[model samples]
Target: KAEVDTSALQNEAIQLSSASGHADVVKLLLKNPRVDPSEKHNFAIRRASMKGYVEVVKILLDDERVDPSVLNNNAILLASRYGHAEVVKILLTDSRVDPSADNNEAMLWAVENDHSGVLKVLLGDSRVDPSEQNNYAIRRASELGYVECVKMLLQNSRVDPSCRSNNAIKHASENGHVEIVKILLNDPRVDPSACTNYAIRHASENGHVKVVKILLQDSRVDPSVRDNYALRHASKNGHADVVKILLEDSRVD
Candidate 1:
């Protein structure tokens, strides 16, 4: 009968620690000689650490049975994704922790979610590669107009400006980010004309006349590129003024 009650208490302590990050409860449970600190529960120290409960995490780490090396990459990954900077710092300091591990997927998650604070930590850790793109962090930031994040990524020497599925320039241009477009254009590695035609078509089709005009100004941009859709789009979208500009270019009869 006593054994059953102790078991129930241990389970409850684990639950409480997982949810509340209350170190007091955990310490009380640890006092029970029968309670196994190392016993794997659905919620463990890793969850507490990810939640930024520094005190509870410290208690769990002090337990001889508790393994600091436990790979809760998913939980740590979530913490980083949500901008839990302190939690990430604790996790990364463990010698067993692999900052560059998981094929850069964690960094990708942070980037895609616009967790700029987490991204700074990840990017600063030389272990993390900036070009890893399963999450398309840089391009996604540009597309969503997260200008500060985009700027940070671009400033990183390791980040490949052109390394993307759609290319940052095209994404910025098509999304009507004139500022981002200008930034990408200034990079020597970015081919001003790389996706100009496609961007022009998309901008015109979407009635983003200002974007079209910006692209046209690029000396590399071929205004004569036969983009029937652009003309058709301008006509359909009631951008007659833009249509007039295209008509005057002498590219369309």
Candidate 2:
């Protein structure tokens, strides 16, 4: 006969078992009336989700006693951050889970970590707003050179590439992500000249020859916009290629 130890020890064991992906043990522990699955600030579920333990999360969610949205929707956020696409999908199906909670932090983590699968899942959720948090998702993805993630975010009609969310183009150009720069420019909504020449200046300072050339080629981007800032930065950084390219632009003073 199995004796029920309804004490604090039982709860700890449940958490440990859940975190370790012991789905069977978690199911057994949840059956006990004295054991609390959501105890300890939802630690068990968060750990399981963070580690991509889909079965463990499923078991916890089935218990009805477990709450996925508590603690700032941490389960979804952690799962997205770790690229647990399946886990994220499961959580999104629950009505209690808010995909846009905490200012859509889940999306932010997904974009920043380049979790393309997780991002795709989030985008499918009608409640998720890709442009939330001041378009932080695309900006961060662009800056980090997460090409796939940026592409996914851009596909969402709700996202305005030209919204000027912290000047994503500038960040992309500054980080020397040439392909990303081209993608953003293709959107037509994004103004290559929006950042007062910071985009070109940053690319020039960082010696990004390809990025500077691309910016110069855009008719909308005036090469001389920032009082020759780009030229000075290229010369100061000793980027002979960038300097040459900028000097070739008749607009650069």
Candidate 3:
């Protein structure tokens, strides 16, 4: 009878977790020796964590059996993806939790969602590398014109402003993020002219006047160094404004 009762309570707790994400029910079930807090049920505490239920998370985390570093669970990744700032905070503070886990997936999630607040928290921890490669966090944030995130990433001395990527300056210029373009331009290490003709032509053709102006003013930029392909593209696309700017400069014509 006791075993059946315990199973019933555990089942009820799971249902409650699924619907309400309440900590009280989770705690009650956890108190039963037969109830497995870490059970892989659909409505487990881990899922609650992903849903941003801080109270339920605290209850689950208190159990010695719960692994704070677990990843890829719908709950954990969802929490990160949705910008559950508080849950992320609690997880990171755990001694057993790995801040750099999942290839810094949490950071990428925060950036993709444009969660500036959560990003600030993650950035404050030195263990989180702002310059990690190929993740949408850095590139997407720059593309989306999240200036604060860009600044935070730039603050890391190890972050290479000129990190070569198809989307780097091209995206920034096309989006009319003048400040980001300016920041990239000022970085001595960034090769503003590295991308293919499409990127340059796009920047030029869009009449991103300020971007063109900045690029032209840079002494390092070879106004005459035309990648034949890009020049033809600019002309073919009928970006007359860009062509005019290019032609106005004696070096380009």
Q: Which candidate leads the pack in lDDT?
A: 2
- Runs in model 3 deviating more than 4 A are 1-12, 15-19, 27-34, 41-43, 71-76, 134-137, 165-167, 174-176, 195-199, 227-232
Q: How close is candidate 1 to the true structure, as a TM-score?
A: 0.80
lDDT of each: 0.69, 0.87, 0.67
lDDT comparing candidate 3 with the true structure: 0.67
Give the best candidate by TM-score. Answer: 2
Clashes of each: 0, 0, 0
Candidate 1 vs candidate 3, TM-score winner? 1
Each model's TM-score, in the order given?
0.80, 0.91, 0.77
Q: Which run of 10 residues does model 3 get worst, by summed lDDT?
A: 222-231
Candidate 1 wrongly placed segments (more than 4 Å): 1-12, 31-33, 49-52, 68-72, 164-166, 240-253
